[model samples]
Structure formats: structure tokens, C-alpha cells
Target: MALRTRAVLVHRRTELDELLDRHATRGQAEFFLRTRGRTLADVESRHEAAVSARRAVAASVPSDWALAEVERADLDRFLFAPEDVVLVVGQDGLVANAAKYLDRQLVVGVDPEPGTNLGVLVRHDADAVAGIIAALTNPPGRAGAAPSAVRCDELTMVRARLDDGQELRAVNELFLGHASHQSARYVLTVDGTAERQSSSGLIVSTGTGATGWSASIAHDRGGRRLPGPTEQALAWFVREAWPSPATGATLTEGMLGDDGELVVTVQSDRLVVFGDGMEGDRLEVSWGQEVRIGVAERRLRLV
Candidate 1:
């Protein structure tokens, strides 16, 4: 069969877009920014850059191939095929947000703003998109193919599964905590040993997510540095494990091997499980529900 090169463009709303949506007018949005000591011109320029980058990417897509545009918010509802080549044209977080919805599709992270934004994941510029796509779809050995040098790096992922058969995958980390500001109650189990605990929340993170919230938790608890982004193991921490007569704090920090798993039974009325900082998209576990977390079987292939 012929190659099916489908470019799935992923992006999120800019500050200007959000401002206009909230204030209902460009003038009102400008005034709102000015009141907060921010410049409307800066927001407008950023928005323009993003638009330019998106247009450039759209133009670069091969005319004979398929193309689809999707916003970050609709990722959960979008059905991604196995042959789709995803091109995320936004911040680094957009790449993380898109990873959970994908299986083994090749993803190209395009940095809309090159110099102004520090993009650890969105490393390529818009101008390079055409060449990347060409190389990926048509290898050098194939007929009517171009000389291309596209490559991909594999990144590990974290997977969480509930006893009821619900599942969630995250490129960064998984947060198991109370839905609100109240304390979370759960029984954490590692290596067959279990402990009833009450504290702030539970964070199970892969190596890719170690630089963010997981790093902060590791620093506060004097834990070791997490593995690399492509590593198979995961590190987990219990945030603010409060000691009580009914809840123990002995099992607070540890590493979960590839074959190993960490299990948690909900003692609270409701505990939320979300990945990659997208709290709106989450799995709710009621009291008596069990959740198992481990390194995911799939890995992200970044081209």
C-alpha cells in the first residue's frame, strides 16, 4: 500500500484569543491588558507569529496528502489513526498534551516562536516542517523519493488504570489527589506492602516529567534525580504525607520498575487522576476503587 502521510496540526489558544473571548472585543481586551501593566502590542505580535507559523506549516504539507487541524482542548475527543503524522505547532506543553491521545504515530514538534519561547519539546522551526515531512514519508531508498534526513527520538510514558477498566496515559506525570483543596485519603501499595495514608496527593512521574513538579517534590524530600526521558522506570512520591493514628507515612517515596506496579485504593469519597496537567480531562475514582500505575507499554516517537 502507498504511504498515508496525514498531518495533524495541533495548537492552543493564544493570550490574545483568550482575552478577546473573555472581554468580547479587541478594544476591551487591550484595555484589560493595559490595566494589568501588560502591553497589548506584545500579545498581538505573539498571536501574529503563531498565525504565521501555522500558515507556513499548512502550506508546507504535501498537496497529495491528508491534513487536519485540532485544538488542544479537543484532543480527548479526536480519534488519531495509527498512520497519522502529527505536527504540533505551539508551546512545548502542547506536545505533552497531544502525546496522551496518540499511540505510535510519528509526531513533529514545531516551535511557533523560536527565540522568545524556551521549548524543550517543540524544537523544530516552521520552515523545517516541509523537509521533515518529506523525509519521513518518502525514504531515500524508495522510488520517486527525495534525499531526506528526518529522525525521531523515543520518549517514555506513564499509564494509569482503574479497577473498573478505565485508563489514562500521560507523557509527563500523573496526579492522584483530591478533586478539591481538601486532603486526599488512600491506601498506597508498593511491592505488595500497603499503607493507609492521608496527605496532600500522590504524584507518579516518568523521566520526561522529572524536570517539572516531580523535580520540586524530589528536591523537597531530598530524593535522587529521576531517570532520563526515554527510561523505562518511573519515580513516585507522596506529597506531604501527614502522620496520624489511622494513616501512616512510612511509604512516601520510591521507584517503580518496568515489571513492577504501584497500587492505590481510594479511601476518600472521590479522588481525581489526571495526566500532563490537564485537570479538566480526568478519571474520577470513588471510595473503594483501586488504581494501578506503571510505565506505559508505548513510547512517544518525536521526529
Candidate 2:
């Protein structure tokens, strides 16, 4: 027997609802719709779409919980693990990832597009998940790869060392910026020496979040650089010479670490750091406080 069973995971994009069938309970489907100024019928249509898609992938788990307004952290509460090897179907959000990382969890990825998980770090593809399952039940080599299986293409899934000698694996990305919005006066230090933060932010990413925030920071780079290119990690800095985009409560920078650990630096008059936007002990980011990131010695994945 294998150490653990393999599983498959899917994510909910706005269009995920459309992929579902009728008579399916609306599972967080409307939340994916980004269309602004929608109509009543439009809202109903979105709900219908989400329900349909969910049905195609998952059997509805009847529940009386307050509507589809569930938060991302609780996305996986519905799916029933009837078997050792299960497939999680939903959009590419916290819920989907949460299941993959949970105890006794294995991940297999599926998407409408063949290479949908291209830029992102997938735990496993449908084929990989299936193969592991098959290897457990049947034999090896004969088993095929899962449909959602796609190779991850990132640059830096690095292990960065901060001045404190604390090394963290940045599976997605990492960076530092203003702790508070009040005219963030930051000094950048790369490799060891100090630099300058002319802009309002800084960012680092793993292969997972390269497309999200890193793509935004590099937006001015004319897209020459794709997502990630460094298994050792490459860094970027954003310094707004004049004024910041907004004031108080603005996300000055973001750091995407391994295992979906997101570090966002928000600055108003106070410099605060958040873990995946979750509140924590507030601290100020000074030019002296050491900060660093990279890949971790322990690597965890699903699929």
C-alpha cells in the first residue's frame, strides 16, 4: 500500500457555475461572477450556472447553512470523503487549496482549459491523482495521468534567508513595502546591502502567485517576463516616487510564501502585516527590521 491516497482538486472560476447542471444547490457560484451591474435574471443565471457546474463535478451535500456566502477558508466543508481517493471540484480559490493541504488530503487538479494550472503550483494533476489511486488499487505504468494534471512552470520557488537567518520557502512570491500608509519611508536591502523604496511597495512571488501580484508589479515591464523563472527566486521592487495609489488601509505589498501563506503589508498611518489578510500582532516595518524569503526545506504539495 502507498503512504497516502491520491486525490484530485478543481477550482471555481466565475464560469464554473455555467459548467454545472440544473437542480444543483448554488454553491458559492454567484461569488465568482465579476460582471458589474447585473440584472435579477442575470443573478439567477449565474446561480444556475454555478449549480450546474458543481453537479457535473460533485454531488450536492445538502446543508441548511446560510446560503452560498461561505468564506474561502471553509470551502472544503461540503465535499464528503466517501472514499480514500476523492476529487475536489471548485474554482482556484482558498477553498480548493485548503482541501489539498488538509490532513489526509491529496490533490488532483482539473480545469476546463487543458493547461489552466500553468502558472500556478498544482499539487497534482488528475492523472497523477488517478495514478496514485490506481497504483493503490490496481498496478502501475498501466494507470494514466489525470485530466487536470498540468506541469507547474515557475521561476523562483526559492528559499530566501532573512537577516534573522530565518529561511522560508516562497512557493508563490514574497516582498516588503510600507507597513503603514503614512508616506512609507522604506530602505531596500538586497542580498545584504541597503537599497531604496522610491515606490510605495515591493513584492516577491513563488511559481504559484507569479501571475497574480507579481504580474501586477511587473505590469510596467511590458510582459517581457512571464511568471516565475527562478527556482532560486528573483526579486522585484516597486517604488512610487511621488504619492501612493491610495491612503490608509491600502495593501502596499504582498509576499506569497509556500503552502498558501500570504504576507500582505498594509500601511495607513500604521504599518501592519497580515497573514493572508488575516489579522495578527501589528508591527512597524523599518529599514532595519530584517526580512527575507525563499523555498523551504519541507515541500508540501497535492495532486
Candidate 3:
């Protein structure tokens, strides 16, 4: 049987929604913003634009295909099918967040406000969504079809797995660090060498995430530059590795090849692992737990 073309629309909360949640009412939110020298009209205008773009995209969906809309916070709970075409209608961060849960599905990043926001992942504007979706559902050489104007680029991802079977994937970077502002204790093993170390945290980053946290570390340390977004290798760095009698700071930075892996044994009582800057949603490991970080088998197909 042929695969069904189901469109899954993904979005995040608007600025107005967040403000209202904190203040409890529109009047209260406006008052709170006024105290900060900001106007409520600015928030309302941006919210209206986002809503309009969402409605326009919804109207453009094919009537014969299955359609589903999901919020960013509920992405982990939602079940994504293999044949689903995911449309992320938000910032670039949302695309990175959605990439973790997705398998091989084709994702199109749609920027609601093309004039105001600049996005690296969300390259397409709202006006081009209909054409992109139509081309994706029906490619060239098919009956009653023209050549597809849509193009897809594959991005590498990073994966982390615990010894007990829990795992997480990230399109940007994975942060293994202490739960609070303190030193994180762990045993780092890479390339047949193991060393005990205490540091601020560990960052395992994909090529796609090189421009973010990994880039900063590379610049400060004068280390090797990161790979491109489509490269298969990953860069690992230990942030502020502190040397001590019990913990050695050697083997703090290196590249992880396609077949290579980084093993970290948790010595801290409250060590957390999170990806794509979503620290609130993280995995906690106690002393003696082992976590392996490496390049993931799956890649993000961006259309």
C-alpha cells in the first residue's frame, strides 16, 4: 500500500498567550507591561499576525488528507506516524524541539512573520506554504503533477542513551550538567581512555548546533571548528573543566566519529540531561549511572 500524506501542523505559544498566563487577565498584562515601558498593543499586533498565518495555513491543507494540529508543549505526548508531513509554524527553536521526537518524517518550517523575525531553520514564509505542501504531497512524474519546487536538506542529530534504556535525541545540542549552579562530577571515557573530571557541565553537539553553544566554546578555547550542519560527526566539549586531586581534566574535548561514542559515568547525585535548550524537560541520573552520547542514526529532513 502507498503511504498516506497526513499533514501535522505544529506551533508554539504566542507572546500574548505567555503574558496573559502570567498576569491572569489582559488588563493586568497590559498594566504589567506599562510598568516596563512597553505597550500592550505591541503584543496584540504580533498575536493577530500569528493567528492569521495559522488560519491561512489551515485553509491551505488538502481536503482529502488527514490534518492534525499540536502545540509545542504537547509534542512529546503526541504520536507521530512514519508518513506524516510535519509543518512547524514557529521559530527555529521549535523546529529543533520537534526534530527530537520525529523519525524520518519530512518537516517544513513556516515562519508566521517573515518581515520581523529572522530564522535559520524556518526559511519559508506563510505565502509559500500552499505550494510547498502541494508539491510535497505530489512529486514530479506523478499523474497531473508538475515538477516540485520544494527541496529538502538533511541535518545531522545527536543521541544520548542511558544504561537502563532511556534515550533522547537532539537536533541542536545536548547538555549534561548539574541540576543547579554547581560542579558536575562524572567519569568521561572516549577513544579508549577514561578520566574522572569535575566541571560545570558537558555539551554534546551536532553539526547543526555548531553555531550555538559549541561555537562559543570553540572560540574561547581556540579549538577545532565544528562540522557543517549535514556532517555525520559530532563535537564534544567539557565546559570549565576544573582540575582536582580526584578529578583530572584531560580528554575534555574531541570529535565523535560515526562509529565512536562518549561514555559518562554519573558521580553527581543530581545530574541532568536535556536537549535543544529545553532544560525543564530533562532526564535525571544519580551516582553510578552510565550515559552514552553519540551521533544518532536518524537525520532531520527539512523541506
Candidate 4:
């Protein structure tokens, strides 16, 4: 088929014609939920307004065509074929479900966060979403790729206590960074070595997170000024690219930094450490206890 399905954005303010233009060029159909900084609960009002403005828009489309922010439970509407992919045209905010799940293959992020593959982001107007959908239903090639990993009972989500007396949770990594400060200062101790830090903080991204926070700081942007094993070296190699190979390797505590100590320091006081990107743990932070961090074996699911 020559692609006829339509794709929808995250129900935010969007440029209709520009979106449609993508379709004109690509020969696909797309649409955006033109919004005005409305809350998830407020999409209904906006939808009503859109209906009043162009009743034909809704009438021509099926009743289940549009997805609302209030009830976004199923991915069935987006999933079509093994070759087809759906675009959840939205930003990372109150309306986004990226935080809710780690399905990068299905929910590709268009915007650039500290983590994530900005390269694959579907950054077009409403029309682009439609175009993508149209192109997907009758994709050009093979079905979805074979599975590499999935969730399991062996996999666990736990809440641990920081030396500073705060609790933290993680699925893949326990990343620490300056949310609003210039620097975050903390010592790194893998196994039993103490090393100081000069950067923002330490990061421990998982293999499951093949394209997230680990992807951002994976660059060797002069952090390796020191000589080889004598100076500080986090991993064996830091890719000049995003979503580097650092994701799938095992982090056996001895792979972080100087003498197995992954110390980190940012210029800011308001520091944050969490798994994925969702806020899990808050700590004042001090250097005393042997930070027991071990790379996890299992990963999670999304689509």
C-alpha cells in the first residue's frame, strides 16, 4: 500500500500546515493536537475548541482516532505492523510517558534531553506525524528486530539509603548531577578505593539504557587529560558519539575511576541522583560509607 494511516502529536500547540507539508513531501498524512500550554486534564476543552473550529477534522476521522492525555493506557492505536513505527509526538513533561516506560524503540524522543538519541527524534509538525503513520502501515522492509532482553523476577527495583541519609531508587543507573548548581561534589569508592572528583557527579547507566543518560556523557570531551592507568579513567573507552557501547558492558564497581573510586563534583549544591530520569532519591551527600554500587544484570521493557 502507499501509506494512508495518520500520526498524532502529544496534544500540544502545533503548526498544522507545516506538519501537513511533511506529508506532501513524503506522501504521508500527519496531524498535531494544537495546544496552548494546557494541562493533561485540559486537552478535552482544547479538543472541543478544535471541533468547533473545524468539525470536519473530527467528523472525517474516527471517534477513536485522537488520543487524550487523561486516558493514555494503550499503545494499540500506535502499533500497526512489525515494520511500522509510531511517533508519540510530545515533549518530556506532564504529558509525556517516556518517563513512565523505557521503550525507546517505540517512543522515540524528538527533543534532546541530557540523554536519549536526538538523531532519531521525529521533529516535525502535526503533518509529519501523519506522514510517518502513513509510511509505517505499509513499511518498506522487515518486521521488528528480535528481542535482546526483557523484564524478569531476577530483575529488581530497590530503594537504598545514601550516606547523607537520603533514599534512592534505580532501574538501570544511579546518575548524580547538578540540577541547578554549578558543581556537585562527591567522592567515588568502588569496592574499597577513594577517589576525588572535579566534575558534576558520578553516573552509572545500565546496558538496558542503551540510549539514555549514559549516551550523553559518553563523549571523551577532554575528561581524559591525564595519562593512562596512572590518572583517572572511568571506562575503557568513551565514544565521541551518543548511545555509545558503554551501555551493554558490566559495571563491576572496578570500572569507574581512579583506584575504582568514581568521585564527582559539580559547582552546584542542589544535586540530584536518580535512575533513568524520574526523581527517586534525594540526599544531602557526604563522603564516609563505601558506596556499594554494582552493575545490574537484567533490564526492563517498554513496547
Candidate 5:
């Protein structure tokens, strides 16, 4: 049987929702914000706008298509099917948060607050969602023809896989570090070069992520040029590599071209590997385990 189309609406809780949850009432939330010289009306307006955008997107789904609503906090528990049409209604970070959990689903990024958010990922305005969905679902060709080829940008992604088979993917960057602020000890190998090092951590960022955390690190370390969003290469950095008799910092940073891989042999008791800054959803490796980081074969199909 042919697969049924399902529209998965992804969203994050609004600031007002969070405040109400914490304060237990609207009046209490108002009082809490007022003590900080902030007004509840502003938060309420933004919250209403976000909620309205989400409802609009949800309403835009074709009547025959199955629909599912998922909060960002519950993404790990959500099962995304291959035939699902994912709609992320929020800022770019929310898009990044959903990208790792998806495999081949096409994502429509809806910016509720267009002018306020940096919409690098969430490119479409909320109002455009209805037409976008109609165009994607039912192209203008034949009476019962298949949908036309989707026009999408294949955004590169980074992946970290351990010898034990646990893995994580991120549209931005993968962070390999100690759970705490303590330095992480590991054997770092990149492009056939290996070194024992002690440092804060390591970051392998995709071109999409080159504009964020990795870029800041590169700028602080004498301005190493990074790649663009659609580039196939990845920029990596070893943060604060402490030099000592047993460890070296010479292999500080480099680029991973197509087919290149970075390997890390855990030397500490336990270290973590998390993507896109989601520390809670991570892989932990103990001493003697090896981790491989590279460009993920799966890319985020941003529509």
C-alpha cells in the first residue's frame, strides 16, 4: 500500500507559557516580570503571536493528511515517519533542534516573528505556510499526478559515532567534552595525524554552524576562515589544548573535506559527545573507547 502523508507540526513553548508554568498563574507571572522591570503584556503578545502562527500552520494541513503536534521538549520521544511533512514554527534554533531527529523528511521553517528572529534556517513567514504546503503537496501539473520535485536546499550535517554504535547528528556542530567544566583527555586524530591532548574540548562544526560557536572560536584564535552554509566541508577546533610533557596542542584546528574523518580515543574516565548543544541527549564514552566524527550522509532538506 502507498504511504499516507502526515504533517508533523513542531514547536517550542512560549516565554509566557514557561513563566505561567513557573509562577502558577497569570497574575503571579505578571508580578514576577514586573519586579524585573518587564511587562507581561509584551510577553503575552509574543506568546499569542507564536500560538496563532502554530494554529495557522496546523490548520493549513490538508484535511486528508494525518497530523501530529510535537513540542521541542518531546522530540526525542517523537517518531518521525519517512512520509511525514515536518513544519517547524519558531526560530532557527528550533529548526536545528529538529534537524538531528529527522532522517529524510522535508522541513518547512515558519518564522512567527519575522523581523525579530535571525531567520537563517526558518526562511518562510508563517502566513506563507498555506501556499507552501499546497504547492508542495499538490503541484500544478496533472489531475492525479505525483507532487513535483521539491525545491529545497540540502544543508550539510555533522555526525559523531562511537565504536559501541551509539551516534548523534547535528545540523550545527558536535561537541566532545567532559560533562563538567573539567578538561577532557583524549587521543585526537584527524586526517591521519594523531596526538594525545588535554583540553577543554573539541568542536566539529558543519558549514551551517560555521557562523556560530565554531566561528567565534576561530575568530578568537587568530581568525581562521570557515566555510559557508551549503559547503560540503567542516571546520574543527580543539579548545584550550593544554601543553605538557605527555600532551600537545599542535593539532589545534583544521578542516574536514569530503571523506575525511576525526577520531578520538577517550583517555578520561568518561567523556560526552553531544550535537547542537543538547547536552541531555548525548553519547558517553569511557576510557579506551574510540569516537569518529565526520560529515553525516544524511542532510537536512530545508524547504
Candidate 6:
């Protein structure tokens, strides 16, 4: 069967929209923010910009191609087609969120609020999306109006798989720890070495995540090194590992090559494994269960 190319637009609700939902009215939301020494004008302006950007993207979709829209909260429930071109119109974090549900589809990050956002993941301006779609639909050598070829950066991702047939993937990092952020007990095995340890949690980060949370840890450890965005290897860290009579912190950190794996056996009553900070949607590992994390088989094709 010939696969149809669909454009999936993923976004999140604006702060103004969220406030209105909580307060039930714009006036109430404004008053609430005013009490905190804030105003609604900035929020409203950003909201309008986001709406305009989305409208522009929607209007630029090719007439023959299928289009679908999904909010951040509904991403887990949304079904993505195999031949889809996913467009994330939000911050870098939103790109990480949508990357979990995708496979081989090409992803384009659209920054709705240009100057405010870092544009690390949402790298394209709102007006450039039409050209991107045109170039994608009409690759080089094809008879079309596309002026240039779009460059795709295949970014690596991390995967966590539990013994119970559950799995998750992320563009940033995978966090395995207690749900309450308390001390977690587990047996960690990496690079052929094994040890029982108790700590806050474990963070397995990819090159893409090196600039975020993992970077902080690296900075703390006398500027310990991490991988680059396209690097095949990944870095793992055991947060605040405490040595005790029954546990050791010797195996607190290391790197995993393309063929390497990190296994953790749950010693606590239960532990949670979430990717890209989405703790709500996670895998639960019970006593004695082993959770293996490694480089994911699929890489994110970001345009």
C-alpha cells in the first residue's frame, strides 16, 4: 500500500488559555496575575502570536496532503501515521514530548514566539514552514517549486525497557527513581560492573540532553564531559549516591557506547522510569525487576 504523507501539527495550550481554564474567565485570570505583580498583556500578546503562527502553518499546508492537529495533553492518545511529517509549534521541550510517539517521520520544529524561545529544538521561524513543506514534498531533482534541499539532523535518543515488556524512548534523558523524589534503592549494573546503591535516582542522557539537566551534573563534577547531539554514545549519572554498609557509590557514573546497556534491578518496593521528564506516563518497576536502558534503535530526523 502506498503511504500517504500527512502533516501532524503538535502544540500546547497558551498560558492565557490555561489561566482562563482555571479561573473560568479572562477577568478573574487577570486579577489573579495582578495580585502576583504580573500583568495579562504579555501573556495575551504571546498567545496571539502563537495562534497566528499556527494559523499560518495550517494555511500553508499543501491541498493534497492530509493535516492533523494535536495538543500536548492529547499526544499520548494521538495516532501518528508512518508517512507523517510532524510539526511541533512550541518550545524545545515540546519537540522532546512529540519525539516519544514518533518513529521514522521527519520532524520540523516551529517557533511561535521567535525572540523569547531559545529555538534549540523549535529552530524554524513561523514564516519558513511553507517553504519547508514545499521542499520536503518536492525533494531535489523533482519538478517542483522548491528552491533548495532541506537538511536533516539525525539526533540520537535513549530507550528504557523493563522486564515486563514495557518500554519508553526520549530525545533528552531517561530518569529512573522514586516517584516522590526520595532515596531510591536499586542494583545498578553498567559496563560489566554491578553494585547495590541507594540514591535519589538515575539519569541516562543522550547528546541532545547534554545541554540541559545532565549538563548541570557535568558542571558540578569539575566539568565532566558529555556526548554531542549526534554522538552514538550516551552518559549516565547516579544522583547523590550514598555509600553504606550494604551499598557502594563506586559505580555512580559512566558512559554507554552504541552497543552498551545499563541494567537496574529494583530493590525498593517500587520505582518509576520516565523519559524526557514526563513522569506521569512511566513504567513501574517492582522488587527484583530489571530495567535495561540503552541507545534507541530509532533516531530523531529533525529538519
List, in order, the clash count of every candidate structure.
Answer: 0, 61, 0, 20, 0, 0
State each model's C-alpha RMSD to the native. Answer: 2.7, 9.8, 2.7, 14.4, 2.7, 2.6
Compared with the true structure, what per-residue lDDT tens digits does model 3 show for residues 82-138? 778888888889999999999888888888887655466888888888988777654
Best by TM-score: 6
Model 6 lowest lDDT segment of ten? 139-148
Per-residue lDDT of model 4, residues 7-66, tens digit only: 232323333334445546313332233243434334344344433323322233333234
For residue 242, give model 2's deviation from the true position in Å. Answer: 7.2
lDDT of each: 0.86, 0.39, 0.87, 0.35, 0.88, 0.89
Q: Higher TM-score: candidate 1 or 6?
A: 6
Better of 1 and 6 by lDDT: 6
Error of 3 at 59 (Å): 1.6
Cα RMSD, model 1:
2.7
Worst 10 residues of 3 by lDDT: 138-147
Cα lDDT tens digits, model 1, 1-303, are 655557789999888999988999999998888899998899999999999999999999888778999999899889987768889998778999999988878888998887655466787999988888767644433422323365677898999999999999998899998977469999998998999999889889988899998999898877677978888889999988989899999999888888989999999887899998989889999999999999998888887
Model 2, 1-303: lDDT tens digits are: 312222333345443334334424444333333334433356565555545544543332212111122333444364533223334444344322343233333343333233444223333333343344433331233222233433322223444344445443334444344554334544443333343434554555544555666677667656535434344334443545444343222323433333322222222333333222222322344345545443444332334
Q: Candidate 1, 62: how far from true, in Å? A: 0.9
In TM-score terms, candidate 1 sits at 0.94
Stretch of 10 with least lDDT, candidate 4: 150-159
lDDT of 5 by residue, 1-303 (tens): 456678899999999989988999999999999999999999999998898888889889888888999999999999998778899999989999999998878899998776676477988877788887787753333222224554788899999999989889999999998999489999999778899999999999998898899989998999998877778889999999999999999999999987999999999988999988889888989999999998898989888
- For model 2, the superposed segments whose C-alpha errors exceed 4 Å read 1-37, 52-71, 75-88, 95-106, 110-172, 179-182, 196-198, 222-230, 241-270, 273-288, 298-303
lDDT-better candidate, 2 vs 5: 5
Q: What stretches of model 4 exceed 4 Å from their correct place?
A: 1-160, 164-166, 221-271, 279-281, 286-291, 296-303
Candidate 1 lDDT for residue 89: 91
Question: Positional deviation of 105 in candidate 2, in angstroms?
Answer: 6.2
Off by over 4 Å in 5: 138-150
lDDT (Cα, tens digit) per residue for candidate 6, span 197-245: 9999999999999999899998888787899898998999999999999
Scored against the true structure, residue 272 in model 6 reaches a CA lDDT of 92
